[model samples]
Target: MKKLILVLVLVMGVFFSGNAQKVPTSEEIAKKNIEEMDKRLKLTPTQRSVIYNYAFDMAKEQLLLYKKQVAGTAKEEDETRIYRLQNEMNKNIKLVLKPDQIDEFNKLNEERLSGIDPGKKKKKKKKGEEEEKVVGIEGLKSTGNN
Candidate 1:
């Protein structure tokens, strides 16, 4: 009986631990974001450094907002701030890029915004259930009808 209980406890602990996701740190977020941009834009070392700073700042702000949302303390202003941060980051990134790079950056932004297909309806969740949260930069925008 004791061995059975020990085995059961170990199995339960492993199952719960496996289910828990570790949230990425702001630096991890920034590094991943910059890596994507580098692949698309072929950014120079200097440009990468500057853009990393912007992405890091944006990620930090987003993490704070996420915490508030999880705590059910998110305010309307948080959404507005997210949009503002995205715009600011885009503008700053553009400043660091060449004219050709700027065009590519703009194209990337357009793709990000338009990636969602409007024709498909979202699956309805049961009452009291929350909508699925989008992750990454795209998560800044609401997935519902605008």
Candidate 2:
């Protein structure tokens, strides 16, 4: 009957939509970002390898803390874990980089955080359309002109 066909279609749509929304793991995100940085910075092979390992470890620790927080762990416990991981990551980074390379690495990370990229062109908004901006606690606002 048509009812059965309609039900099957609806079920299939729901299943596919859910599959499409799968989020990447933190490790996957870190690896992707590290690869992007390597391409942008033109890092040497040795530096790339070292940076990849560093990013992986840092991301893994962060992901663990995030999982705990999401699982309703106490805020204090999450903060403590994050603080300890940050200290360890900082110490490891210092050990991995040479004096000169450390400066370059820091600069690269800063640029990445700032979203500065020569290869990416900023899109211009149409008249009467403004860039969407996020306000602290207030959520997102649509500007009339961007």
Candidate 3:
């Protein structure tokens, strides 16, 4: 009976822990972003400071948007706004980077963008199937006549 209770408690703990996610604070997000940039672009102290400021502001904006979305109060334009926010951050970061670092930064951006799908799925056409054209009322009338 003790073993059964222990197993049950362990399973319950795992189930609850698996569903909980902790959101990062703005500072944490900014620190992470600059760390990645430092690793990839070899940023100097001045560049890191400027980029961290940009990243922190972007992260705060993103967190606000995320909260609104979770509360079901987000506008349709909020989706586009997130992209605009990131673009602004990228532009500011580019200004602080050297010419060579800018090339590496662009490549990183491309790699990140490539992973996202545009939320569109094209319908697949079957083999030997011709595309269908819409017929107007006049054309339908002509086809109905023997």
Candidate that scores best on TM-score: 1
Q: Assess every candidate by TM-score.
A: 0.65, 0.53, 0.63
Residues 10-95 of candidate 1: C-alpha lDDT, one tens digit per residue: 33334335655776678987897788789889999999999999989987887776677668998878857776777778878898
For 1-85, candidate 2 gives per-residue lDDT tens digits of 2232233233333434565566446577567757776665566788778877776776666556555644777476565655666
The parts of candidate 1 lying over 4 Å away from their true place are 1-20, 116-146
Local lDDT at 2 for model 1: 27
Count clashing residue pairs per candidate.
0, 2, 0
Instruction: List where candidate 3 sits over 4 angstroms from the true fold.
Output: 1-21, 116-146
Candidates ranked, most accurate by TM-score first:
1, 3, 2
Winner of 2 and 3 under lDDT = 3
What RMSD value applies to candidate 3?
18.1
